[model samples]
Target: MTTPNESPKDKPSSKQMICENESSTTKKNDEGDNVGGGVESVDGQNMSIDDANETGIDDPKGQGSSSRKRGSTIDVAIQIGSGSGSGSNARKKREMEIPRGEPTCYVCSKNFTSWKAVFGHLKSHQRETPGALPPPTFTPTEGSPENNNDDETNPREQLAPTLLNLALETMQKMSEDSNMSVVHRPSSAFNSPFWTTNSGAPVWNNNSSLTVGARAFFTKPGGANFDRERIPERVVHARGASAKGFFEVTHDISHLTCADFLRGPGVQTPLIGNFDLVGNNFPVFFIRDGMKFPDMVHALKPSPKSHIQENWRILDFFSHHPESLHMFTFLFDDIGILQDYRHMDGSGVHTYTLINKTGKEHYVKFHWKPTCGVKNLLEDEAITVGGANHSHATQDLSDSIAAGNYPEWKLFIQVMDPADEDRFDFDPLDVTKTWPEDILPLQPVGQMVLSKNIDNFFAENEQLAFCPSIIVPANAPKCVYHNNHHEGFMNFMHRDEEVNYFSSRFDPARHAEKYPIPTAICSGKRDKCIIEKENNFKQPGERYRSFAPDRQERFVKRWIEALSDPRVTYEIRSIWVSYWSQTDKSLGQKLSSCLSVRPSY
Candidate 1:
């Protein structure tokens, strides 16, 4: 019988015999034959070809159906292939295991089966000395074995040319358009055109102010045109600074909310923000629900008779609504007199819902934290700053942007699951309350950077209006308003049924027709409209308790002094006593003791 290693023209070489021995120690080879002959076993016994068949062990070499004894030792001569011995074997093994395909480099066009080979090739192409040769041009390798161009045009190259041609054609067409050259007439000088009455009739030669022969008959310009240049200031947020900025989302909260703005990172929405401290940081107030908003503003505003704001008027108006006490704590605190707009924080001051793509609604509250951190000026600082410049905040915002030092505010929202709203110590939907960051953590949404200053104060800043109703891509879930009849007539009368139409009509199919419906529909619910019921009082109470015992005493003393004012009525003082009692019983007792009055139930 012919042996496996025996060739047609050559006797089996010693190296071949050793290889056959090594193969017999392994599994069967390619052909069905036993080829083991030479090679010493571990026990110093040479494995012979007959030993493989005698032991009845399965073929050790994968080449053939030969069998050998287990643990048999074999000696084999090592053979070198065409290239590096071990390295060439490894390459052959990998090539056989890994399917062959065209090689491509992601970074550079240099292609090689091994990246190390590509690296060596790249180094050789580089000039040895600095500036010794021109930069290697990335020419399209054509007809070289490396280039595999199957068609006349490369798809990417063809796309580039087509886009360039289309762009050029668009530019040429735009150049020929008549609208491109249209000119708009600019407004003439204010007084040179002769200031006119509201009727538009010119009032010429007004140097003497409508005088009778150099003797002034009418002192003012014209009674009718005198007040034309002036308009009524905003009822609230009257003293404020306006800034333009973009709200960019930095967090991925798509799972917790359906609001498009908080869906992912890098989404930006245009915003015009206003900061005010007519009496508090939280302007555009959400008092005891939406009904009390107009009334609260009316009470806080300057009296119609004196045209001067009096603390007595505000205290009396809010006294009936005991919930106003929570807000009063903030308004009475040092934060009420922030020296400049930059130092104060902003809050939505209402509970809103975050709807996710799955239609899950989570109660949420928006907060704006200054990147510079909270720094409030004391009463003395406010007196000095306000006296020095009434427009200090506006000037600061404008100058900061111009100097390339933009002011930034990080936007965060405290979210609570709707089912867990009642689990908190305070109501989440109450406008009079504030969320405690310790319990319900503040999740960062994004940042607002005021980089650009408005060009026209009147056209851009003054005329711009912002309502809580505006819904952008990232707004929270919708809200419903409900009212109790026990609320006063002023409050109950304002329970806007037309506004809270969503709850009445549960059909979402009708939503498209009412897509742009104003937020006016849901304005009457007290808990939903007022202090965000979730996370409100706990934060204030913690803030109050954080003060040293002595400081807390001083705070109660100050409150008592304010409440004990002779102008403040007994009922108002009693209401305040109860309010502080709810905040801290000891605080209320101390205040009542200082006022020299028994604590009212």
Candidate 2:
């Protein structure tokens, strides 16, 4: 097989020659199928070597060509002979007996009618080759000892390259506990010794169908194994890592709330987390009203048409909602991009009410301060780190827990009296506003320690859910809270009572003793209007002033870049500059200078 310029000195060894021949043969076998040179046919259509390779990999007998050839023959025969009268009758019987199920492939999201088909498809994804090399189509070499070209008692030769590739793949998949001994079993559904149908009838020979003396074939398609592998990803915090831990009460807040989870000091509940403290790395949210939540998310998400997230889209969307300015101050600030989940702080974001045993109500806001001081990645740093490993934060958290560097967070609350709500210029319940630390200090409540990593992320983290409506009676506002009995999607709760309504005579569930709550009074015609106290500029101006000189310049530069987008209209640019000028004159002037656009205000 040498070229015209070949020398005897450059002639490859027997092993090298075997490898070259096998590699070329495998490539030709795969490519030839596309060019209509394949040997097998299924249902009047040519079957590629790639399909054969998939079957051969999943074949329990191994990837030998003899095993594959037998399987292919059986498949071809089954496909061609399936249109007979008896086969038609059998299919009709199957259709009547078995309901159709669309089992979806988890990897590719492809749907199949039978378990056999889906499982067979999954085998293709499971095949792993070395680096960029394709999966080996193992065909036995003629001169190899296993199938020697010339039969002999004694053999002296190197192993075939196909076998070598298989050996390397097997070695790569071996776990660290490979040496551990195990007792083998052939128990029910425990790695059945023989191939079987879904109904437990052992398949005598997988290569051929069960036949009555070659008169008719009675091959039964396996039942569909429908796998609901994933739950709907969270709308907001879709990408996050959660760790298990207990929230221990450190302070006596019995006067604050009569929640069983918050009963008294030293009292604890196993899984009743400290008020489902659902929060984000950033304290403030993008929108204030619940009505705008969906729209805000739509804008923040990838474009509907292109499916790509662009800053221009986000900036344009938020440009309409000036109240989002304060939030963007933090979003575009020095700590805009967090390094990891563990290093960032969290907030409840919304104001809640707390009732004392005496029925006195107080407005409360919750916060979680990380024990590890807050850390963040700069814009350049975030791009580089995120580009390197998209799952860097998740990996960091898991690695830290495995290495025993457990992360901890301290719980704190800021309480305000009902009358004092008017004392502040901003609305206490407005989610867009942050209760200043200088005015209303954070009260120490308890601490949380995530010492253990979850065993199964899907079972624990993915299925886990929480809702603000799940609040205790004491934390719930009297006039605002009401039962609508609206069941949500993916509600995992189990209830088995005929009476689903509250206050039913048959139901034993009774309302807790009344506690004092705010007497919220509303007297207005239903109309769409903006909040009267939308003093959106002051806090943002304060935030801008609080930043260091260099940081402020960076912030201005970022705004300038966003405003300079050719897609951004002159009106939008003027509006943003005017808004910034309202916040800080110097900032507006700086941006105006960079973009060569005059501030409207």
| TM-score for each predicted model, relative to the true structure | 0.49, 0.57
lDDT of 2 by residue, 41-118 (tens): 212212211122311111222333322221211111111222112222221111111111124454465765433344
Q: Which candidate is the best by TM-score?
A: 2
Locate the minimum summed-lDDT window of 10 residues in model 2.
Answer: 92-101
Tell me how many residue pairs clash in candidate 1: 41
**Candidate 2 Cα outliers beyond 4 Å, as residue runs:** 1-231, 271-274, 471-524
Which tens-of-lDDT digit does each residue in 1-601 have in candidate 1?
1246544354332212122223323344343322244331211112222232322223223454343223222122222222211122321111101111122332355555432243334334332422222222333344321364443212221212222222223223223443322322213312345666556777553322332321112334344333232366765565656666777889888887655556689988665522221223562243544434555667887887899887778778877666665665666665666756676788877677666665666788888888987777666788888899888888987888889878888878888877786677766655666766788898888898888787777656555544455321112212332323334522313343344334344433233322222132222322111233433234456667777776665567567667766788877787777667667777777777777665567
Highest lDDT model number: 2
Clashes of 2: 1
Q: Which residue ranges in model 1 land beyond 4 Å of their true spot?
A: 1-231, 258-260, 272-286, 468-542
Listed per model in order, the count of residue pairs whose N, CA or C atoms clash below 3 Å is: 41, 1
Provide the lDDT at 148 for model 2: 55
Alpha-carbon local distance difference test for all models: 0.51, 0.59
